[model samples]
Target chain A: MNKKIKQNIAFFVFRLFSLLIVGVLISILGFIAINGIQVIDWEFLTTAPKEGMTEGGIFPAIVGTFYLVVGSLIFAVPLGVMSAIYTVEYAGNGRIVRFIRMMTNNLASIPSIVFGLFGMALFVNKLGFGDSIIAGSLTLGLLTLPIIIRTSEEALKAVPESYRTGSYALGAGKLQTIRKVILPSAMPNILTGIILSVGRVSGETAPILFTVAAYFLPSLPDSIFSQAMALPYHLYVLATSGTDVEASRPIAYGTALVLIMIVLFFNLLAAFLRQRLNKKLKQH
Target chain B: MIETKNINFYYGDFHAIKNISMKMEPNTVTAFIGPSGCGKSTFLRLFNRMNDLINNTRLEGECLIKSKNIYDKSIDVDELRKDVGMVFQKPNPFPKSIFENVAYGLKVNGVKDKKFIAQKVEESLMAAALWDEVKDKLHKSAFELSGGQQQRLCIARALAVAPSVLLMDEPASALDPISTSKIEELIHQLKSNYTIVIVTHNMQQAARVSDKTGFFMMGELVEYSDTKKMFLNPDKETTQNYITGRFG
Candidate 1:
């Protein structure tokens, strides 16, 4: 075979590999959407599950997941953003900083199930929070902390150094320059990171499983201390350990569909915010 | 008035600027001319302590503005910077509107009176000779302006703070000839109100806009004299060679 023919064959192999991944993703999404669409309805979404988790809606699980997401964001966003700022701006490339960065990367590489176990020991048992919404949110926040910090640091670093210099030349102090220039320029990227974290927090079942997930709770959680049903855990229960797994299959599909839709909504929100911020930043 | 006394600056053991002493009178344009990496820009940055941002930098000497040692422990660097403004080689308007770009210094300094900020923004733009072209679109983005206009806007931003000294690091080297002339004319007009220290590679630009000139070579101030004498009758052979286009 000639060089051109060999090159063409190599290119074809790479194309096939790419298509294989895309094909797998499309097939999974197609299966979920097809099986899940039939079971979704206004009544099913708004009401609590009934008849041994086979007949009613997953309203309480939806509300519980919403609370978990909001709670995790509250703990995670500010802490993540501040950590990123300190790492990127305040901390020089010293030995300590490098060690801290390495630790963060290692935390990111740890398995989600390990985070679940840690959360179980720390928040659920030692902290005496038990299997509650607050514990679960905190666990999820921990699970996603590395992602948020790394992404936010990248975002802050992406802001050009010139903007800081311009602000400093005008007699703005470090804080003033960061607040008035650096933060605004990096806002879009930071939002993207937060959105990604949100997706991760919402879809996670392992961390919450041991820390906060309830086997069967149909009512809305009234406070942080209350046990709540989350979408992922509810889906897991319906598909695996339910009294009648065959009858609960549709509910499981619907729960999966709702979880996917929530993530999609957050992704859309991030894109919209990025576009709006870019426009504002560009405006004279 | 500004003066530096036997200044020696080092960037982490790299001797960037050698022993140099020079004085600049208030309300006059003084220009420093040299080739790249000759430390003309470094010497200019010393006035505002802009070089402090770099790590492992050392300075041995006093930089004085109006008889006050700016590098003294008691001197507030931010206050000193406010009094001495700098414009870079490239136009760096804040990612803000024209009005806000000019008003940034005041806002950062805790100036909150709306009328005062608005008045100062207009005055600075007028001083930079960019008012008429952008007067109607004061709220437009600074990036929308042409290269020349953006540089003028940066100048306007520096002027809005009412600094006693204005430093330009090749402010017009990034512009076309017409824009360069405009900046030169603005500098000439500005000298009545502010002391100006400019660094440029363009010999004609130094001769055109500066009252006094300092020629630097290899991080050393080779000659310092009136612009006319330096260009017409230099005392040093190296200065003569440089000005006559024999070599940089």
Candidate 2:
């Protein structure tokens, strides 16, 4: 009886430790959901900001966020995919490959704020893109570069060497093997990486803040030179300094909740894609 | 036909294949009979320059395919590989449909017609003796097949390119007896069209399939002669001991 009691106590302690972290997260999410759901309205999502408040609706921010995701994908994908090819296909465990790998790992661990500062000096100031969507997106692209490279490298690495040998034995050159066999096999995982980058961008207010100065333009961007409002910055302002604290509270929570939902939708999408691709892969 | 002259290989100063010189005739199946780590597979890979992939690996002397030295700077590896096809120990099919697996080479070389690819895929499958089983499921993934079927698919994939020389590195080592025999029969049928060179540790397999045999031991060619002579009367005591149920 004593031994069983001791065992039960141990199990309870372990359960408590696990629940402590999970419980806190769940409670936070619940609080946000409860507080935010009422603010969700069609007008709030579609309408522009009113007066100087910048808290009325997130239309401009939504547009800006979309631009950010698209622009970053354009810049980061080819570079990441090419680097992954070099690392996984041609590179041995030599000094240069090891160095590139080390740099990639280091890049992933870097703080977003530092990237913001770098963007401020590099794109916003030096290159003269100013507080434009392009500047902010390039910063985000830099931020997501290492992630895509590492994830793609991992996906490429996960491909069996037998596949390459098979291709080569079939008389395929280097590019053909990578283009047809390796790239297609690694696609779903690469998509997951890009999706993860999108999630990373949607949550980033700090990187855009320093890089893209608040322009509050009501019109859509006609060129890369225009400054834009990001969803994260808009959410920050709505939560912090709105006209009616009680009324704006809902909008803040709603935006966050929407962001979370968007992220979750993408995550689930990635999971679905991974599942389907894995099934197809198993058939081969 | 391939002829190696005083060939040697090294992996970072460690000798892998030492002074291997042998001539393989057209339309003849040559079995490389050996124990493990005797550099049989290494020697086989030299014909298509497959060994050029290994880091810090250096080759000395020449490997000639039809009097053209494959190691010369003018030699296009892509073209060399097109002429010399290889099948590995383990069956490796691409993550593609059955038809695509066989038609990969043709597609890469820019054959765009749909009907031609289909015809070639069927012809290769028939040549590899797998058309009857997998004909209906041509659109299915290559990995959906069993190990034996996958190996045959690999063979079909190789044959689609119509290479003159085929190198098989322990082609039946991972297969069951029935599947192995099927492969042997397929090899026999293919001999008239392809110069088949195979490496195998199974003495019975080597004895059964090969017209000419080369027994290798410790990175050296011990004996090369008619399969019957090697089995019935070996030149070396070591060859006799290794082959006649004495030692490997």
Candidate 3:
């Protein structure tokens, strides 16, 4: 009715929406923790499924997910950081650089299911790796590549222009300037990008679904060629397609909780790393 | 010695530096005083080829240092820069220790002996008049120093490469009066070994530290002469007006 009332109403609406998001997040976490906490123990975390996906911990799946994450990071981190350095530093702001940026953004927007299918055709079938850890990792790496590149580019760009000029003024070449000054300055933000990619790569089910995920694996994957049970896919099978979905519901919830915890751990690690790097860069 | 013969520079389509000629003798301090956007800083940067870092910039005419045309295709830019060091308006030390900031030049130029680098760092800092303040904390971060100290650190960084020429682009504009005086004193002391060219907005600073003075306006060098002659009895009316603070 009046300006004060209108402003108050707008503030109330915005506050309500923000609180609603927190409420939804808490309810989801609360639901999973309450349902799965009783089932989780050292044995549940360390042993394989025992009775047709109805008992025992999702140990093989957890190990498989861990391996897949490490493999993807190995494949993606260097490639992504290098690509970002090229696009941001070497390429200059030209038509080709603009095109590369556009393509990266487009790649980020592409469906994860499309990546899964592509991985199946390329790494799994054409490359003849079949359903294996390598294929799955390569797929997940592709899925995370755009994220890493974009974030790394931002990190590199955030470095002050004065640093580049300062390095150049001291008779340093471009490569030397980048190596000695730019990279160290941008390292914190670049590491943040890598950690964020790790979080996203861990929870993704689609890209790894056709490439390496197994409906049931008796043991952990021994090599890159072996098919492995992954947490997201294991949870999917337990909740939706297992022989007794109701019987495996608690295990499915536990798997979801573990996946969430892994993501949370990485997020915390990113924050911790950023703080440490900022302090080190600012002080010693 | 540094000389520019009728040099003109363009930033894309805009003429940023009109035809200008000047000579700076070895071991003498020459100051360019001008209003903002007068291209004094741009003209100063030409000696080190620092302007080349900007995109779509064009230069015509010759820029020479020590009788050799630095603008020649045969000249290696990195080598040119090694001989012509530049200090910027803002003190830009890398995110590194005080010692490392000074040693950066030597490290990048492939100087490997740790003992030699350490020696050079101390000498450069001493020359910059910052060694006594930071000598106890060489390994400490450069950001911990005061702004004036940081500016001196930048000068130390520039001097560490053993350049024969030094370019100061308003090196004391961002500092307090005490720091400004310290930098000006440092400039005076440094003139015996390095040919220094400084661009200053502060006219008194130009008169105090320079052997020669050049007044620039609208991308043109309006007057160039001995500092005393230029300040007391300028040959041009515009120079007189600018020096006397009649107008920029």
Best by DockQ: 3
What candidate 2 gets wrong by more than 4 Å, as runs, is A1-6, A51-56, A213-215, A244-246, A282-284
Candidate order by lDDT, decreasing, is 3, 1, 2
Question: What does the lDDT read for residue B17 in candidate 3?
Answer: 92
DockQ of each: 0.82, 0.68, 0.86
Calculate model 2's interface RMSD in Å: 1.6
lDDT by residue (tens digit), candidate 1, B152-217? 999999999889999999999899999999999999999999999999999999999999999999
Which scores better on lDDT, 2 or 3?
A: 3
lDDT of 2 at B10: 87
* Minimal lDDT window, size 10, model 1 chain A: A212-221
Backbone clashes in model 3, listed as residue pairs = none
What DockQ does model 1 achieve? Answer: 0.82
User: For each candidate, what is chain B's TM-score?
Assistant: 0.99, 0.98, 0.99
TM-scores, in order shown? 0.98, 0.96, 0.98
Candidate 2 per-residue C-alpha lDDT over B159-244 given as tens digits, one digit per residue, 9 for 90 to 100: 99889999999999899888899999999999999999999989999999999999888889989999999999998999999997
Alpha carbon lDDT of each predicted model: 0.92, 0.87, 0.94
* Residue-by-residue lDDT tens digits, candidate 1, A21-116: 999999888888999999999988999999999988999999999999998989988888998899899987889889989999999898999999
Can you give the lDDT of residue B220 in candidate 1? Answer: 99
* Tens digits of lDDT, candidate 3, A166-240: 999999999999999999999999988888898989999999999999999898888999999999999999989
